[model samples]
Target: MLLNDRVCVITGAASARGIGKATARLFATYGARIAVLDLDAGQAEEAARDIGPGHIGLACNVTDRAACDRAAEEIVARLGRIDVLVNNAGITQPLKIMEIAPENYDAVTDVNLRGTLYMSQAVIPGMRGQGSGAIVCMSSVSAQRGGGIFGGPHYSAAKGGVLGLAKAMARELGPDGIRVNSVTPGLIQTDITGGKLTPELKVEIAKGIPLGRLGVADDVAKACLFLASDLSAYITGAVIDVNGGMLI
Candidate 1:
């Protein structure tokens, strides 16, 4: 158990088929106490129950700094100290730039970019006080290759910002024994994409990937666990690609 006895906080963990939920489950399996944060209080609580005891669920609007701070405080109160922070709360809007609405763009940026910043900021104090911690931000292959398959321009831009933020935070926090990194996943099959992908579209995407398949939530979660563990102690400001050779 690489994360044995550690406490990990994962945002956007309520959805049954979300990457955040998979990451939370993986962290729990590795013996970490989890704090599952999501916008839906009931769903978050249900997720916590599914993960079994010794875990907690909290309602948090990651876009709101005050709410994020409160959630972090609540987690600390229950779990003692936070050892890992995963900024995984995000959303996507699939529309062409010309057709995209201002509200859609704002919504995507608010959750994907601003939300990541708020969550990271809220947890930095606790991690700094502990003298050691890891932070993982969820970027996307769309950020690197410009959203050929997944999200719209705004979504790609926001995810790109997440990568940049992770790198900057890594440099600033490294001396304090806190490491920051980002993971970019490619064409992952989650509830977010299920509604958008037709049978023909899924086949088209699979053919483009060298691995011959779309990515699963576990693929990203495994990469996250690696970054969260001491195995990555010397690594910071690094972007791990969990894209199954889609970008290569």
Candidate 2:
């Protein structure tokens, strides 16, 4: 129960198979009250129900600063204070640089990069005032290795921005006792991958990892838990690779 009696807010938690949902569940299991924020109101509420009573759900579009601010306010109103924030809302567009449309590039950047900024901005004041908090951004191995199997140039650029944002925030917020970090997950099986992965594709991906397997949502969630806990109190501006030695 590293997070006992804490309150954690997870964005993009509506998808049952997403890293955000897994992180929310793990946080709740560790005795933290969760605020599950997603674009879909019903799904968010349903996730909240599954997490048990006292947890809450709110509908928010993180790209909109006002909406993010409102969601933060609502969570504080219900949960008292926020101790952790996991910026896990993201989307991927699997197209070559030449094939990517301007709209698609903007959309990916808006959610992956801008959304992270808005959510962090909305939550930082409370964290600073409390003199302690943790912020985890959902970066990707794509940012490091340029989308080996998951996305394209646009996705890579957007995720790279997340890494930069996390590091900058960590520096600015460390004096206030707020830790900021990013987790770069490799190829993880999720609904975002679209249905089930093909046998050949899976095999090809597995061959590239030293661990010889694709990652699961729990792998990233567990890394997030470590960053959120007091065990990482002295850590900030760090990028934890949950990529199973793929980058190494």
lDDT agreement with native, every candidate: 0.93, 0.92
State each model's C-alpha RMSD to the native: 0.9, 1.0
| lDDT computed for candidate 1 | 0.93
Q: Write the per-residue lDDT of candidate 1 for residues 161-203, one digit (tens) a residue.
A: 9999999999999989999999999988899887788999889
Q: Residue 47 of model 1: what lDDT?
A: 100
TM-score of 2: 0.98
Q: How far off is model 2, as Cα RMSD? A: 1.0
Which lDDT value does model 2 have at 208?
A: 85
Clashing pairs in 2: none
| Residue-level lDDT for 49 in candidate 2 | 93
Candidate 2 stretches greater than 4 Å from native = 194-196
Candidate 2: tens digits of C-alpha lDDT, residues 47-141: 99988898998999999999999999999998899999999999998889899998999999999999999999999999989998999999999
